[model samples]
Target chain A: MAEQPPESARTLIEVVPALGEVAPLRPGDPVRVVIRFPLGHYRVPLYLRGKTGTVERLVTPAIDNEEEGFGRNAGDRRYYYRIVFPMTEIWTDYAGPPHDNLRIEVFETWLESARHA
Target chain B: MHEHGPGESRPHDEITETGPPDYFDVLETALEELLTERNLIRPGEVRHQIDVLDSRTPALGAKVIARAWVDAEFRARLLADGRGTCEELGITFYDDTGLIVLENTATVHNLVVCTLCSCYPRPVLGLPPDWYKQKPYRARAVVEPRALLAEFGTIIPDEVEIRVTDSTSALRFLVLPRRPEGTDDFTEEQLAALVTRDAMIGVVPVTAGKDGSGA
Candidate 1:
């Protein structure tokens, strides 16, 4: 039943480093996964799109997985962050405790600084 | 698991030699011999590592959790860094994958899932369970963690928060289940026995039952 991942997920290849310099987001920074459904390779979950969360941990820079079809295993690198989002923020009918939340690693290319910066 | 190794002979052992053709057995033998001929991995080393992988189970993770429960300093080190801390306890990681230990407390209960793929802490918990990698579990774990936990016979009170962690990156997650009460006088080994695979995976909490079974 692992059917949630888009068809692009099956098309992803190896990792590749980006050729650029950028500041990595630190823990406690608010961020949101880019809300887009572009076809091809991407790691951001569909349910997490447009959702906001705080950076729980600053993971090391990782290779860009969005080769789509070309430049795979040779794309620019991006920093990864462990983003924590409340369940209430993810679903309208979240029935658990209000404090319940979700955490997932998101690439810099798939994320943007959220409001309340 | 009921199968025995080494000198123990099974009833079908004699017939197995001339029985059905196995693809993996031939492939593994060829690969191992070629690697050995190229001065790469030795056959003995390969056999030893096979044993290591086969022997690795949730017990290894359970032991680590038990140690964390008894020793504050070790627990702190485990929280700060999972790989180095496990290595400190003499647990060797076969690969470079990082292990991130998520602590469970009275306020928060942690659950782990790999929504995109079945990325798991194999070094600590061996292979991921079949259900963990399946599509339904992956799809629902994060969306309805409380419901999923309830399906697993775990009822988390409303006061306790549930933290669903999706292991989407290279680093894998292992839930450090809360230590059960009434075990203060229990030995470290006894505590380890009570810690089950489901508890370490955060689907359930560790219980203090004498009939400790299941991986």
Candidate 2:
């Protein structure tokens, strides 16, 4: 059989699904939802870390930055997928408008099921 | 080695003799000093690799979004590898960053904000608008995205989930908003018409109203 020529030098790339490969919660499944921010280690937004909420949707699978060689560079390039709690659930006095929500897309590594759960 | 007064006017000649260094002078001096001391982010031939952000072309990511709107496989690739796929569309992200491109599908919505400092992806999406840079928008968007979106005229139904994307890195985001209806076989420019600065930022959906062109 004629050997197929070496693959073209073109770069291989793909968009990560909002959440990459995380098994979705069956409507009633329990999850520790959280907001994720993308930045260098020197600065992580104070409001988001370690806070807990629930996942709203699992849209699709995507590239995992951890496996990608970018390192923090990986973190810098793209964001992880997530949509955590509603506004009321996150804040006690979020009195700006009616039924506001703060859903976010976060990387998988940032999440861990709450011990309380 | 020159200096300028704090709030005093000086002629160009006087200033050149004793004023703050322009970029060229500073670069020359700094490079000489660095070579004399230590070599770092080297200041050699300085082949100015200009990664020109399309200040005139609006947010280039919008075009990618529009393409995803019409092409299913391309959309899948976008969802799979946003930065890589963007490269195919000639949207090369800056080094020291991995990009995440989120789709604003019919069932979902996306919005972006920078709460800490204005860390945006200037490589592909140009600069953030004044509103996006304001402290109010930054602090509040992550706290109350829906309310903020409403202020921008995007009223998401309770049934549909809204996802807020906060770009903390100088890593910018561009929303691939669900394509509007009645645009089958739309030309790239026509499709581009549906891509707006607001849509890319996720402040609002693309529309052909007011400007009668884009969202």
Candidate 3:
């Protein structure tokens, strides 16, 4: 499910339903970015699809940017999670040391619970 | 090494007048003029907004960093709540976007990037450099940050972890670089002058010279 996006990427940003209000995710919880490339205005980078990471923080809930990108629903609030992925996990041939990592803010809809090793 | 002072025009600034206008440029002009014509926005509002944006510079962020370096209480407040702490210093937020200050320490170095879009801390730092908005830096910053940073002459030791922060949501990030050594007696203003835009962006580290300007 973590396959990379095709080179000839087409634009198909779908303004889907925002995730419903649920239990808040806490720091250190394992989560993976949902792997689905619809080609539209997605904030989740292609490199992170299906890759698991630990939650760094539960940032303040904000309006969903996917809908806002299409100038549609602007008031629908969605939680944004700060997830941190180690460089080794992100790139198979990560040249840097194992200590390097990347943290990014992903909306609730783009994430799913993952099993912790 | 040269700096562009306020009112000194850059090459891109004169694009509309000199270079051929692109599709987005035409769209921007049309929207701006239409807003004025329709009385939705005042004639001078656009220019005023531009002036406001231009007024914000890295110096504003530098002040925040220097203050944090010298003052412990302010540093705690800034780490806990970046937006509120910045507003306390009179740094205005023109948009709904929020700011997050990522502190760099001996063990960890922080770098900020917006992989999806060029979302930046514009209120504190005037504008992002052209290279920041390009695809190479955006893509490689997250994938191979060490190599990308090395090109900028910032060689992070293996012991020190490199953490790249991607600004995907409304939150914008600004790196608070560690104060260089031997500046213990330097005044706050002197320390502020040492802070650079690239350092704040996490591309470079701040260094002090032997000129005794600060000490």
lDDT of 2 by residue, B90-158 (tens): 776645555667677666787877776786656667777887788989987887777777898888877
Query: What tier of docking accuracy does candidate 1 attain?
Result: medium
Deviation from native of the Cα of residue A17 in model 1, angstroms: 14
Instruction: Give the TM-score (0 to 1) of chain B in model 1.
Output: 0.80
Per-residue lDDT of B161 in model 2: 68
| Poorly placed runs, candidate 3 (over 4 Å) | A1-19, B1-28
What is the lDDT, from 0 to 100, of the residue B59 in candidate 3?
A: 93
In candidate 2, stretches whose alpha carbon ends up further than 4 angstroms from where it belongs are A1-43, A54-83, A94-112, B1-38, B44-59, B169-172, B209-215
lDDT by residue (B131-185, candidate 1, tens digit) is 9989999999988888888999999999988889988777888899988867888
Which one wins by DockQ: 1 or 2?
A: 1
Q: List the residue pairs that clash in candidate 3.
A: A12-A39, A12-A40, A13-A40
Report lDDT (Cα) of residue B147, candidate 2: 78
The DockQ for candidate 1, computed on C-alphas, is 0.61
Residue B81 in candidate 2, Cα distance off native in Å: 1.6
Evaluated at residue B71, the lDDT of candidate 2 is: 82
lDDT score of model 2? 0.61
For lDDT, the strongest prediction is 3
TM-score of the first chain alone, every candidate = 0.73, 0.46, 0.76
* Candidate 2 root-mean-square deviation in Å: 9.8
By descending TM-score, how would the candidates be arranged? 3, 1, 2
